[model samples]
Target: MTNEMDNQLAGVGGAEPAGAPSRQEDRPAEIAPTAPEPDTASSERGKSSPEQHAEDAARTNDAYSRSFPSLSEGDVVQGVVVHIDREGVLVDVGTKSEGIIRRSELSRDTSIPAEEIVSVGEKIDVYVMEAENQDGNLILSKKRADFEKAWERVQEAKEHNRTITAMVTDRVKGGLVVDLGIRGFVPASHVGTGSMKNNLERYVGQSIPLKVIEVDKERRKVVLSNKLALEEDKAHRKAETVASLVPGQTRRGVVRRLTNYGAFVDLGGIDGLLHISEMSWTRINHPSEVLKEGQEIEVVILKLDLDAGRVSLSLRENQPDPWASVADRYHVGDLVTGVVSRLVPFGAFVRLEGGIEGIIPSSELSTKKGTKSGYGIAVDSEVEAKVVDVRPEERRLVLSLKQARREEEQRRERKDVEAYQTQSGGDELRYTIGDAFRAQQQSEEGTDQEEE
Candidate 1:
């Protein structure tokens, strides 16, 4: 860059503008007065010969060459911002004239204001667009310099496989556009983990990390991938999550999918198996009954096979065991009500609260006369029974339906006996004629109802 600057300076120093006459052609015209009343002093000064005027012009040009440094086009040089305005910016590139950076040259993005890109008195690097324009003004550009530097940076990153972050600017037909100080294109196939075909507008204005996959400076083309970066990050997190997992630890996860036997839970980065057997304390025929896709749940780590990258989780492990407190809740001779769950040849199983099932032997199904075998025990029927025994450690419970019925009958008989004693006033067997007549009338009414 320095050599180029020197070469341009050598060509222009002590020289006049190309095809511009050296005071000889302009002297005659200058001596001719523009106004009728030409000043006498100006005419006397114009009386000098063309040769003398040309010598003075050469001296002046030489002085200017010695005073100002030369600036060449295509050279990126350090500059200090001297002034800024809506129209353009003035930058001092160590030249006689402050270089003008047009609004267009400031940045490719037209929406950004000049004040935001560079402030007064701020030092920046600018690319020389022209040493001097037709208006004798030096032209500079900041965007061109940035573009060159950005390409170099992007190329280096691609070589080293480094990650970079840039803001998504817009959505194109085949991909997304990002401003990496240079235009960076992210193909649709590389937008994320999978080929994203929808909702791409949501990424506009978002800052996303990317990896430079291809770079071509000659054609000014750069290709990037957001999917590769995401996949890499996910794999890294999966490894860490797997290494940190341990049995019995609880974790929060989302149910991703449901299978016949189990559900797949996403534990942040990795997926773990949640078998149906561990979904609840009670039996379940399918995983859908216990979990739904996309539902969030808490589960305990049941096991891990790190070598195979497999994990097993349990939902019921986090729940309290129903049998744990059964002994404290149900005592001997206590009456409990439940629905008949299953009927078998030996007994009927009743589903108690908290998924506890208590069994009643067939002999205790009922004590009512004329009740046939298995007549009183039907699946899904509500029933009341007395708890005869409880073994929490062994998870066994015994219930008898006959005992509950017998107690109810005794309560009714005691009430009747008390009524008779109260009427007799002495526990003596006695009945008045009116009471006998009333009893006969009640028996006749019951017989009449049966005959009808």
Candidate 2:
């Protein structure tokens, strides 16, 4: 059994032992030796130590920091919104991590949702509220950033006497509040060119141009004015208008105000005085009879005082003069009917056609004896008169009522004589004359006999 076991072991060592030559003879011919591989860890150790690798990584981090600037509290940096939610917006400000803008920091209107203020992928400027929070996130603000930038611009505008446009956000007790990236106040008195006593509400939600009057940075107070800007522009235009005005020129104007004596007309930017005497050709007791406020009319530039900035306008000058052709319409000895206009101590005034007034002397007022000065002719009564004198140059006309009555009586007497001659023939007329003479002779004889 030992012998068999040894033979089997020999056979296992060499599978072909039974038929194979020797073990050394059975080996493959021309076998070459192989080279062992190098240890990877040992090679790496030779190139660089772990500490060296750590140093390389640190250097790379520093280069990255130089490329992208670091952020700090209160720093104003530009960023892009990555996401928007009810709480706030996630903004990528090139920091170690994305910045968080809380809902309160989005805008002054806290009631509005954050999504309405900022949208994803929208670039905005943010103020660093905190460099890093407890959760290792940056806290940012959008409203504060906007406020800072607006303050800088406002300060510059105030210094340069510049004008800006803003929307009126709210109405307050003393004035209105406007949003110029920040709160700007406009007092009620400065709201417009005229009085705004109860019209402050009209400016709400309106966007208007304003001039920066005052700015207090520490107090965050800014005062703006709309009236001042308007006044300044008006003054400039008025100067130009005044310079261009010339006497005897016609212009269109709007009635701005009225007084007992005259009306003020706005000729573009400047105001001109329109005297009551120049309102019409005839006469007027008050300016309201001819004009009203805001009435547009054509006026003649009667006079201009450039140095004093005064203008005299006339509306009647633009109309035809009534006295220009008075002589052609009236003449002496012409009988006319007129209305008794006014009474005076010496005589009464009679208004003829075309507003022409004629004077009737007290002596000419009546033809009958024992009569009053006015001859019972009250004011506004109608009467007939003869034109005795006419002086159109002096705007005077003399009338005689007595002469008119005397002429009428003479005409009636002539008419009565004509009627008597027509009723009797020629022979009858002769006989009547003879009889009249005989009656006179008989009367004389009787008287003589009585005397004897």
The candidate that achieves the highest lDDT relative to the unseen native structure: 1
lDDT of 2 by residue, 1-452 (tens): 99999999887675563665765565665663457799987876677778879977899988986886778788999999999887788999997678998888999889988877888899999999988789888899999999999998888888887778899999998888999998999988888864855588888999988889999989989999988777877788787888778899999999999999999999988999999989987656699988999999999999888678789999999888777787888788888999998888888998877766789998887764445678567888999898898887887788998787666655654575567778775745543656545654564455335433
**Candidate 1 residues 353-451, lDDT tens each?**
888899898787666433444564578889899999899898889999878866765665567657887887856577666765666456445533543
Model 2 has a clash total of 0
Once fitted onto the true fold, the runs of candidate 2 whose alpha carbons sit more than 4 angstroms away are: 1-157, 163-172, 175-184, 188-210, 216-220, 333-388, 398-452
Worst 10 residues of 2 by lDDT: 443-452
What's the CA RMSD for each of the models?
18.0, 14.4
TM-score of 2: 0.51
Give candidate 1 misplaced runs (Cα > 4 Å): 1-71, 75-83, 90-99, 107-109, 112-126, 135-138, 166-191, 195-208, 217-221, 242-260, 266-269, 279-300, 315-322, 337-388, 396-452
- The RMSD (Cα, Å) of candidate 1 is 18.0
Per-model TM-score on C-alpha atoms: 0.59, 0.51
